[model samples]
Target chain A: MALNVLICDDSLLARNQLKKSLPADFDATIVTASNGLEALTVLQTQDIGLVFLDLTMPELDGVGVLEAIKAQALDCLVIVVSADIQPQMQQRVMELGALAFIQKPASADKLAAVLHKYGLI
Target chain B: MTALHFTEEQRDCLQELVNVAMGQASDKLARYLATMVHLQVPAIKLVDTQQLPQHFAQRYQQQSVSLISMGFFGDQGLRGEAIMLYQLANVDVLARLLEYSDDDSSEAEMLTDISSVLTTTFLNGLAEQLDNSFSYAAPRILSSRDQHFADKLAATAQQWQLALQVDIRYQLTDYSFHCDMILLIPGEAVLRLRQMLDQILASF
Candidate 1:
């Protein structure tokens, strides 16, 4: 089965940038949400396997989303892609249940390496 | 509203750039105070000189504020100003955090120190991502006492018509400190900035 992917961010530019940086060999179908609430709606309605989450959004933020995912025991892997590079933030998100963290303006190599590390691609 | 001259894509790009830059700045501030810093999504607009005070009223609402300004010169003949407006209400709490004495000079010095961290971290982050170099002047206190910042700015900018304003707010987790940093790209600098934005868009 082709896994479904979700990219959630408030900024359209960030969404597009992350979308374009996906490794060529990654075969998941791409889905998108502009904020955390929209992301939750999609997660509930679809069989998403992976998610790229951003912090510091309007409505519910990425941390809120992670907490909800943990509370709901959602069945998808979340990798955080955000501009909030504080060590504490990174630790908090990973503790909340993100599989990994990637800084903003992510490169294809970094994305590919993480995917490979987890055998997602 | 007369031809703001920024395309939706350019504006989106600028906002994201600001998000990254402001994120770095907030991290710097958070580490400095050893507290979580909350950041508002950066707001960008082009406004006439007449509307500046309304913006002030809408955001600040007659609050006493301290202000500082720094000028930045970009390599592409782009020049603009960075203004940091610190709310005056919570100075005592912040003074305790910084361990500064309660004298006016000490307070002024502390404000400048904090302002220096924010302005330089943010502007340098923006410049680095844009692949441009910049030089900065020493920080200047526009109004560090009882004066209203909006009134001083209105009097100062009567000769101008348009300004590209990027407003960022930072508040500590305990609400013991607050500040608004406004970056203004004026006149021909706006044109240069638009070109830079387009170039960035082209790269991706």
Candidate 2:
């Protein structure tokens, strides 16, 4: 079965970049959300297997989304992709059970490596 | 001058870090604009709140400016604000460089988008070098028109006793446009940052 992936970010440009970074032949049903609230709604409505999350956004943020997932014991994995390259932020997400963290302008190679490391490929 | 909030070594380290971050931000801008963006040697200073208004006025004069500002926080109560200021006269020029239609709405949207990317990219670059994680609020447009930019900055400076200011000049070589990016880090954050630097220096 193809994994269900969600890309959540406020910027159209950033969301597009994350989508493009996915492996060309990767098999997955991808969804997109522009903010944390919408991201949670999608998580609840869809059987999301993995998430590419951005940190800074209005309405809700990446940390809030992570907290919501943890609070509800959601099964989906999260990989943070953001321009907020603070080590503490990365540690916070990881401590909250994020599968991995990737910086902004996510490249195809980096995405592939993370996906492979998590055996999501 | 008043006693320096940061020791010379700490100041030097911070300047180097800011330079690296500015370089990364400029590279991203270069790719976005499809042109080379040059950054002047950044000037970092620690100044009192009373001096901020006068300092900004002296630097920017009477130019109407557009400002994008955001707040960021990290572990151990580290926090600061990053503000990007551009002369209002160049908005249309910037829109054209970005290949957007020369309309008021388009210029506004493009300016916000560009500021968002630049500010976050620069902050993230700095965070990575410091080996720390930070969370930032979404960027907001403080002003998008010609106005007393210095007065506005001064008013905001009232809440803080001291601030570390990093001033950078961003020049778009292919286009006749350049702007100043200023980072205002409050004294508390600077103290924490100094601790982090000391730790790093000791490690090395």
Candidate 3:
């Protein structure tokens, strides 16, 4: 059985970057969303196992999306992928129940590690 | 006699200060771009306010400039010294530099969205280094009109005729793109800044 994962961000470059970095052998269907609002739309319709999200986005930021996910009690792992890597920013994402705070343009190794830790790889 | 103003040499000193600030800023930009970012050594200059129109037209003839201005105050009175002004590059430039593709229009909607994070990270770092309180409201966009630009800046430096301006350029790799960062420190603040740097050096 393959895991289903979602990649949500406002940048097409980010989606392309995620595709190139994800583990090739990992059997999962990776879905992409443009922002938080679309991520939620996809969630309502798909069986997603995990999410890699960007923080500063329009139509809803990463924090807001995290809240929506929690509000609906969705059983999916959430990881924040952002460029804002200040120490305080890391704490804020962690406090929001994000499984991990992976900085933007995360390396393949980092992505693999996060997925493996959650048994989603 | 009017208050003493910053010469090219004094501007160079400030450029060094800017280099230190931007070097730290590049680290944050690299994380966002998902690639290494390097800033080149800047060419420092001291231009009168009257020369700005000719300077803008002659030097940046083909580029559309974008300005982000903010008010700074601490250890000195209210002074509008920090501004991140850059040429708004194409999406392709932003894409390659950021390691993103041409599909995200939202990414280009506001300079504040992309550059503001870098500014905040740099300012916060500078504050830590200077051991001073540094905070500014969100940066706002502005035009480069001679009269309007001069008027706004003149209001900030009511007592002083000349101000110290530091200009630095940021080069984005994995793509051929660059942006400018200009800091306009008031005459009073310039002396204070030099003193602050000396104090920091003494500590080391």
Choose the strongest candidate by TM-score: 1
lDDT of 3 by residue, B89-154 (tens): 553577555554454344344455566776666556555556666777766655442224434434
RMSD of candidate 3 to the truth, in angstroms, is 17.1
Measured against the true two-chain complex, the DockQ scores of the candidates, in the order shown, are 0.69, 0.02, 0.01
lDDT per model vs. reference: 0.84, 0.77, 0.63
Instruction: Kindly give the stretch of ten consecutive residues in candidate 3 chain B with the minimal lDDT sum.
Output: B144-153
Better of 1 and 2 by DockQ: 1
How do all models score by TM-score?
0.94, 0.60, 0.49
Residue B175 in model 3: shift from native, Å? Answer: 0.8
Model 2 residue runs over 4 Å out of place are A1-121, B1-4
Better of 1 and 2 by TM-score: 1
For candidate 2, state the interface root-mean-square deviation in angstroms to 1 decimal: 15.0
lDDT of 2 by residue, A1-121 (tens): 8889999976555566578778976898889998899999999988999999876666888889999999999889999986545455567889998889886557799999999987878
Error of 1 at B80 (Å): 0.3
Q: Give lDDT tens digits, candidate 2, residues B27-136.
A: 78877887766445567888886787787678667777877777888778677777777887777777777789977677667877898888888888888877877798
Fnat, model by model in order, equals 0.59, 0.00, 0.00
For this target, which candidate reaches the highest lDDT against the unseen true structure? Answer: 1
Best by DockQ: 1
Ordered list by TM-score, greatest first: 1, 2, 3
Candidate 3 runs further than 4 Å off: A1-121, B1-15, B43-47, B89-92, B95-108, B144-163, B201-204
